[model samples]
Each structure stands twice: as structure tokens, then as C-alpha cells.
Target: MAGGLLGTDVVTQIGIIVRDIEKTSQAFADFFGVEKPKWFLTDTIDKTQATYRGEPCYGRAKLAFFKLGNLDIELIEPDEHPSTWREFLDQHGEGVHHIAFVIQGMQEKITLLAGRDMPLVQKGEYTGGRYAYIDTVPQLKVAIELLEND
Candidate 1:
């Protein structure tokens, strides 16, 4: 972890929480002159095994992605459930939620970040991967998401 926690500082995705994914996604697509990527809802709690603050979380969000260069711009519209996305939107309004990096050794990375004072906030599973959100705003001014593809 010399260069960075996961051995790389390269960010693969920037996640933004929005109150209106349909409008925001359309705006982004129009601004970039790219076709609007189809928005999809995340898997349910049972399927995703999502947790928030150490508790089972039923929250989910509508997601859309814009691939730009090496980074993916993600738009998230969170449901009313208690999720990091929903909490961020409630407290800070629509804005960047997290910067994600694809990495291996998810558990080790989480432990290392927690030792450095950035603890885990929320985590969940996607179709092909798992993700953990680290509470790094105090030090980095933004959250860090670790995505582990299996």
C-alpha cells in the first residue's frame, strides 16, 4: 500500500447521487452528445446482500453510466431506503457520492482504510462484483468505493 491503499490511485468510476436520474442522465447524455444510456435498478437486498452501517439494508437505486475515456460517470437515483446514496442525497443534495477503484483483496483494503480512520459505510453485491464504500470525506473530501469483480 505504498502508492495507495489498493496499490493504485487510478479511479475507474465517479458516482453521483441525484434526486432525478431520468432528468440528470438525459442532461449528461445531451451535454456530451451521446445516446442516453439505459437506466437500470439495482438488484434487491436479497440478491445484492446489501448492508448499511453494519445492518442489512433494503435500499436500492436507479443507475446509469456514461463511459468517458478511462472513467465511468455514474448517475444514481436512490430510493427512500437507508442507503449511503439516500443518506448523501438527504444531507448534501445531488452531488458526487464516491470515487471508485477496481481492485482485488477487498477485505484487506477495507481493513487498511479503517486503520487509517476511513471506515466502511455501506457495501453490496452486483451481478459480477462486490462494492464497499469507505467514509473518506473527512480526509479526502469524498467517499472511496472499492469494487471487486469476481
Candidate 2:
């Protein structure tokens, strides 16, 4: 269970696509009785990188994260950039986009999924780590994000 690839039955974060981060973050904070979460602009992300359908691509989004007990609730406001967030908002409207798992062997997990036909849809690097969103809808019913935190 510890080293297995995610979507083998584990979820670390619940990500929701929203239209407005300020409004939605405040709403969720108010409802959960917690302080407003800090929002991060994807524009500031370092080592930024992405791909769509196996081709190089780019996207921007505003994100906020709130802790709810042991799990995290993430809100994403897709900007004009072409990204998974934008795609989800465009196709499905605002809703749950994906469940994430912090993995140890990031590339290994990605390769395993890729072997099974789950192509990497988006990827980017931040301060201490990187993340990749896999198009795993066919089997998992939702995308799965693999994170490697330093």
C-alpha cells in the first residue's frame, strides 16, 4: 500500500474547479468555519511545463487550498491559459476535477499509468516539487494527480 501507484485506492486531495477563487474560497472557508485560504497564481509557478494530448501546451490557474481534517480541499480558478482546469470548466462546468496523491516515485507511477494508456494531460513544477495530472477517467472516472514533494 505504501509504494503502490495511486488510484490503486487512495486519494490525498479533492480538487474542485471554480470560476472565482476569491468568492469561492471565502464561501468554503465560511462554511467550514476556517480562515480564508491563501490563493496562489499559477503564473508564478517556476519551472513551468505542461502537455496536452502528448503535445507541449501551457495553462494558468488560481488555486487555493483548505485543510479539512485529514484531507485537503483545493479550489482552482482556471485562467485564460489552456489547461486541465480550463478543459474541465469548459466541458463539464464547475465540479470535482480530480483526486490527487503525493507519490514517492513520481516518474515510476507516471510510467505505470502511461503503460496502461493514461496519458499525462498537464504538468508543472513549483517551489519544492512537481505535479502531473493523468487522464485516468476511463478507469477511475476522474483524473488523478501525481505529486512529488520535496
lDDT of all predictions: 0.94, 0.83
Per-residue accuracy of model 1 over 5-121 as CA lDDT, tens digit each: 688788999999999988999999999999999999999988999999999999999999999999999999999999999999999999999999999989998999999999999
The lDDT of model 2 is 0.83
TM-score of each: 0.97, 0.88
Best by TM-score: 1
CA RMSD of each candidate after superposition: 0.9, 2.2
Model 2 vs. true fold: TM: 0.88
Clashing pairs in 1: none
10 residues in a row with least lDDT, candidate 2:
43-52
